[model samples]
Target: MAAAKSGGITAYSVKTKTKNVPMVDPVIDVKSGRYIATGKDADGNKMAAIMSKATAESHIEAGNAKKGSGWSK
Candidate 1:
């Protein structure tokens, strides 16, 4: 389990049935009219979490992550 941060992005791992797995190197993407943050879990498995557009932009501009593919804003 990666160190969890307050107000940080987290993802659930279906393969491991883990909850609140911290996301590493998160990147924001717009898909189907939603903002999603994606990254890898502690086990190196891919994960994603739905987030607000404002949160996505803040994370991106804060140098915490990059805008993923299909990101229009």
Candidate 2:
């Protein structure tokens, strides 16, 4: 994988509710190889959020391109 640009990685905050009480914390990136988001719901239930490799790459490329000079610029 190409070296992620400095500060490219970001942590997403997730909130969980305990007995109707909400608890917020930064979600940890725990995948051994690549980063992925997975865990239970606020009530502690199994859930999955997966994205295709090609889709991820396209997003990254779009981001980098956006931080550049366009024809209008």
Candidate 3:
């Protein structure tokens, strides 16, 4: 595993109904052709958010995360 980036990606959390919650140890993935970022919230609960391909790629490029299986930066 790579070192996590500081102040990691922030996205809406459906579980807590919060906005701009920082995600820890985020990993980018592709699901049915859409880019998705999955990680844990401050409470340790799993959270995932759909993001643009560019956003995912940027994260991967910045060492924030590695490209998931079947995906590339």
Candidate 4:
């Protein structure tokens, strides 16, 4: 499968079986390490989860969504 990107960032707005079960962290960076599903809007709608290039490609291969593909300024 081919991965899609926005603004040169490959991110996935994955949804869990239930809203409660799937939660993106309200914060993105944690301890200088990448955190999974850590973006949300003021309305609490989850934003895309960033993954690393390696992780993103791996998930693309496995057909699973892995976190880590965002670059920080």
Q: Please tell me which predicted candidate would have the highest lDDT against the true structure.
A: 1
Per-residue lDDT tens digits for candidate 4, residues 3-57, read 2322122333344323222332333332346444354533465655544546544
- How many angstroms is residue 45 displaced in model 2 relative to the true structure, after the best TM-score fit? 17
Clashes by residue pair, model 4 = 24-37, 25-37, 25-38, 50-69, 51-68, 51-69, 52-68, 52-69
Could you give candidate 3's per-residue lDDT for residues 6-72 as a string of tens digits? 6367777778987778887788878799887888988998887777877777777887766776574
Instruction: Provide the global lDDT of candidate 1 against the true structure.
Output: 0.75
Score every model by TM-score. Answer: 0.73, 0.25, 0.78, 0.28
Cα error, candidate 4, residue 13 (Å): 10
Using TM-score as the measure, which candidate wins?
Answer: 3
TM-score of 4: 0.28
lDDT of 4 at 38: 51
Clashing pairs in 1: none
Better model by lDDT: candidate 1 vs candidate 4: 1
What range of 10 consecutive residues in model 1 has the weakest lDDT sum?
A: 1-10
Across residues 1-73, which tens digit of lDDT does each residue of candidate 2 receive?
2222342322222343222121122122324434343334445554333334443344346452122111122
The global Cα lDDT (0 to 1) of model 2 is: 0.31
User: How many angstroms is residue 11 displaced in model 2 relative to the true structure, after the best TM-score fit?
Assistant: 15
